[model samples]
Target: MKRIHDSLIVQTMSRLLIPLAQLFALYVLFFGQYGPGGGFVAGVIWTTSMILTFLVFGLKSPQGRLVEKVLHGDGVGLIIFVGVGGLCLIGGGEFLNYANLEIPGLDAPARRYMGILLGQIGVAVDVAVTGISIVLSLAYHDIEQEYHV
Candidate 1:
């Protein structure tokens, strides 16, 4: 991570923005119980941070490699989706029904909320990686519109 003083606007913004994104993501995660902005928003926010991180850090390493990282995340997201769906498949009621399902240590409503968040997080990862992949793809094939012949 680049230090604050040496950071360019991109780096500075990336560092600042990731945390802010996470803050809001968690806010949406928790606050959704009473209000709106639950799992979906949180997932989007969570994934977006990765995109920003890639932009700032240039995506050189394993962790920053959106394509590779996203590959694994896709499976993760799928598993979460299916898990929630399975809960509904059983006598648990609707998909991710926290009220009826009885899993120890996790409250029914809380569990449902958590389930929503997990699903959203999976979506966010997919979105962010897709965004990064698009950027990379475009980098390979420049439109050259700005260049004068």
Candidate 2:
């Protein structure tokens, strides 16, 4: 099989398409509550873009360093997700009960919307980070085996 980086067409297309894919992922993430797409779809799309970038640029490249930078995002996202639920509990409701979220200015419906959106955002972030981490681990393993490290 032809290596992805060895194909000029593949490299050029991936460069051109990665940004567009990520943008679409954002759209899916934000509009998910009202539409067919959601955090998981968006996260998968984003991860696909990152994978394409890694294939084209190699893991040592600047773009690939993004994976390292975002490894901690997994925890942050989990915190956001759990924090939202904890807030609901503090508001005298069950975990993840958005209707019980007691923000100062927002009413019940608005609170629900905000809670769901924030949760989805958290899920997206966590999913993206986890997927990227898995790919990075695999790549590192391959490298290790290749050089017998």
Candidate 3:
């Protein structure tokens, strides 16, 4: 419940760095289809940002707002994954059948690509949320246990 850094230089640098770090992580996550990065690497990057925020600014600091949102949206990740799967099912195929989805003004291949992108996003979110939760649990177990009761 305290800002861990003592120096103004560290704090100012952190404010500039964390958001940029998170943006780069998200770029990796979203652009995975065209290049090398994917959900796993992006999730790790995202988790690193959360852990770094917690370390530099402490859990109660305003700098951790993004991490707090990630914590609260854990279930949302699951819902997104399931909902995408359900979309495949509703599109007249088995669960997660990306090829069967139909989109207006697009061919089957385009729909397939869209489905793949959506699936990747869902997985990325789920993995990132899970990683963030695990980090928080391990790092702040004592605080959580003390407060949740």
Candidate 4:
């Protein structure tokens, strides 16, 4: 079977669509809490775009290198997610309670909003990185089998 990266049409469409998909993912990430989408949906959208790029451009592509650079971001995301809850504890509230998040300039409602947003961002980052890592590992396994490495 022919590899997907050999198709010029697919390459062109992927190059065009990847950025748009990422932008839409951001839109979903931010506005999701207010409406129909959320962190999980945003993460899936972003990961799908990365997967499309990987399939169309191969593992040596620039975007693939970028993914490698960010492979450790899952830990950072987890930290952010946990840190928000920790902040709530510091503010004299129970774990994961957004209402008690204390910021110097924000009132209770604003602090809660910020806490929720931060938690969502953390979840999105974790999910995106985890998904990309899985895809990369699978691709590496395929390459190893092909080359008997």
Candidate 5:
């Protein structure tokens, strides 16, 4: 693997920008319901940040561990999506019928909003995990080829 200090300026800049990029990704995720940015864009940003980390720090770095965690979490989004649908079905409504969720403390609109937010979160997690998994596999393959050659 290449040294972290391959270029002083590049190292410093990437280190600084990575966190900011991740923060912006989160911002895009939360504001997606109201604006243009959403799960897909947020997932792209997440993939970009992970790839940048791998490029800068190499495969053996902490970023690799993070990628592994992401892989493990890959199915979480799907589970959430299905779980929500199941809950609706159990509530005697059609699949994904947010209106059927009855929380005594909150009104129908609030329940619907919560359901939408959960669905969006599931999508975001699914997309981000898939993107990260692809990038990690490619990175691993490249490294394996490099070492074998």
Candidate 6:
């Protein structure tokens, strides 16, 4: 993609930014397990990374790359989210009860951990979609120029 603002400064900022965004997202997702975040946080985090990439790299090409990754990840995350429901049914315990199945080696508490993990994957998709859509719409307006109705 073309660099943003036609400036070396923007390019440099982006090169530094993308990874930090990802790391922060992961932190949010995992930290949610303890506080109030989870899959949604992860998804948002993914989106944020893409957005920063686009903001720094420029819209056309950068946006495409981000969208492509989001689409692919969204698909995989969605399948897993659905699959978790299937597991819930087989394991028995309402829709998402993971407690009924004997995981062979895992204890009861550990089963809960697994369930949370699965759920978070679903949440990640949600956050990512939000970020991607927001960035996409923003691309329509040229920040350096004014928009007219």
Name the candidate that leads on TM-score: 4
How many steric overlaps are in each model, in order?
A: 0, 0, 0, 0, 0, 7
**Predicted structure 6: lDDT:** 0.68
Q: Write the per-residue lDDT of candidate 6 for residues 110-144, one digit (tens) a residue.
A: 88788777778776876687567666655555633
lDDT of 5 at 56: 78
TM-score of 4: 0.88
lDDT of 2 by residue, 13-82 (tens): 8778999999999999999988899988898899888887877876556886675677767677789899
Q: Estimate each model's TM-score.
A: 0.60, 0.86, 0.84, 0.88, 0.85, 0.74
In order, candidate lDDTs are 0.59, 0.83, 0.76, 0.82, 0.77, 0.68
| Candidate 2 structure lDDT | 0.83
Misplaced by over 4 Å in model 4 are: 1-4, 143-149
Clashing pairs in 2: none
- Which residue runs does candidate 5 get wrong by more than 4 Å? 1-5, 145-149
RMSD of each: 6.6, 2.7, 3.0, 2.3, 2.6, 4.8
Pitting candidate 1 against candidate 2, the one with the higher lDDT is 2
Q: Candidate 4: worst 10 consecutive residues by lDDT?
A: 140-149
Per-residue CA lDDT of model 5 for 6-115, tens digit only, reads 77788788889999999998999889879988877887897788778777766556765575667788789889877877787887788999877655687778878777
- For residue 76, model 6's alpha carbon misses the true position, in angstroms, by 3.9
Compare candidates 2 and 4 on TM-score and give the better one: 4
Model 6, residue 22: displacement in angstroms? 0.3
Cα deviation of 110 in candidate 2 (Å)? 1.0
* Model 3 TM-score, 2 decimals: 0.84
